[model samples]
Target: LNMANMDGDETFESTLLGEAEEVFVERIADDECILIRGTKNHSSASIVLRGPNEYFLDEMERSVHDSLCVVKRVMESKKVVPGGGAVEAALSIYLESFATSISSREQLAIAEFAKSLLIIPKTLATNAAKDATDLVAKLRAYHNSSQTKKEHTHLKWVGLDLHEGVVRDSVKAGVLEPAISKIKSLKFATEAAITILRIDDLIKLEPQKEDKKYGGCMDEE
Candidate 1:
């Protein structure tokens, strides 16, 4: 094989050289052509193979399953049974209106039935509290009566009056504590509610600068 072309410099003629030309030719002859050809073919084959096209699809399926599981868990965990009757009633009225817009008449009926079930417990709690308050007031008044009462009846009334008084005092004390404490708690709750409501508002509002004196983007040019 000609060794001059393999050397890098085209100006050097291999035939004119003696021992240097022989050594270069000998080194080139020792290299395995089979090994070089096998390595190049293996690399080309690997590039054409494109192993595991489903790998990304499998990853996306797993991600979707995990996301759906999280959503299902969240929906299952919600246990707050609507507190106020008025709030429930209001929700029912709104939901009823929503049900009316449904394309399916059967679905609208189901929605109405569900809203009716939700309203019952809320109404019961409200009625129970109202009854308890009225009964407590009636017992207090009867016990305070001066006319022709037995000793036990008067004593029972006195005990009832004392219990009512204690409850009244406790409630009054709770109301009278530092206005600052109530104001701070109110402020915190208000701030949290406002923050939740104004989240989208923040995105809509333009950024304002506190100091016009320091100059703005308009002054950059």
Candidate 2:
């Protein structure tokens, strides 16, 4: 599909999207290729993954499938969370602020949890071979200032740009995630961690010997 989308009034406010009909795989000139047929609704594309080995193509297929699923999720959800650790960084900031509200020892626990939350971004920075501690400190400072100024209310997509080692707007960078998936993952992770922590059982099982097959009968005799 390569035409402008028109309404009943023929106002061309949007563009048509492409879709596929069928794909045929064949060999051409001793090389593999794919033939794609376009649908009436749109168009089609053919991708032929080539590698030096068979396993490489299989891995490429898996990678392509994962990428397609991610794109589909992003399109369907349309609710974006920061991909470059912005959401986790924001959550950490909120949690730390929330911990300060409680006067009980639970506040310390909450604060610890908040600290743990920063581990995600910190680890990300570390994995990128950047300065994790420095990034984390900068992130906290940025979030704290934002909280005080309420900048987050206006711009809520701040994240640590590991590539540049600076705090930047992730939304503008197009680093996003499906909000539903992101929130659900966080919820499930918290629930799972709490469930594991509350577990106090240590019921170890020991191997038992088999019973004598004819012992009861011998006693009767």
Candidate 3:
């Protein structure tokens, strides 16, 4: 069959090698790119990005890479957690309770660690131009309420709804993130912080002194 976009001088000849239920062919603009459809399985595909400048193209490439990473993460782990800082808030609450059980001096560190987790939600609320203190308090209340519930079904995935400028259930709002990614992020961040704290040596740069006279005590007129 000849496509409508085909020129009179150009001809496509093919024998009926197989039978298919349906087929679709369309010619793309001046590029003459042909799009074929009605296939049960697609083994490969092409991605084309067009932009007026290199900066935009670079950004598009990075965005595409991140999207692919997320897909691969989901495929490999097959597990996800609530996003919008819900997980962080929940972890913080748990850690706080855990710190209370410890009577040793180490409890201070654990308590601080628990407070550190709130930075995620605080940063999110700050970025969204909402009242970070108020929203965080509300989020803490939601998580605490969920924790006190006797039934597992009452558990909530509470987090900030940036769009609404309030706290809500992240899972119900469709805010989700790869569990592995979140775990890796926390692991790496904690390790880096610990490493910095373990370092004993400190390097400081001394400020340069201003010359009292211009070139060997010479005074300007």
For TM-score, the strongest prediction is: 3
Local accuracy of candidate 3 as per-residue lDDT tens digits, 1-221 = 65444455654457624444566555543365655455555666567777888799899999999999998998899999998888888888888999999999999999998899999999999999999999988888878777777563344587789988887777887888998999999999899989988999989999876666664465658
Per-residue accuracy of model 2 over 1-221 as CA lDDT, tens digit each: 44334543433433554455877887965677677676665434456677878898799999999888878877888876777777777778888889989999999988888888887888989988999988888777767677768645634567878888777888888777788778878899899989999999999999865558964344553
Winner of 1 and 3 under TM-score? 3
Per-residue lDDT for 200 in model 3? Answer: 100
Clashes of each: 0, 0, 0
Overall lDDT per candidate, in order of appearance? 0.40, 0.77, 0.82
Which residue window of length 10 is worst by lDDT in model 1?
154-163
TM-score, cand. 2 vs. native: 0.71
Model 1 lDDT tens row, 54-98: 696577677777766645544665422212222233334445556
- Identify the superior model by TM-score, candidate 1 or candidate 2: 2
Model 3 segments more than 4 A misplaced: 1-40, 50-58, 151-155, 208-221
Cand. 1 TM to true fold: 0.19
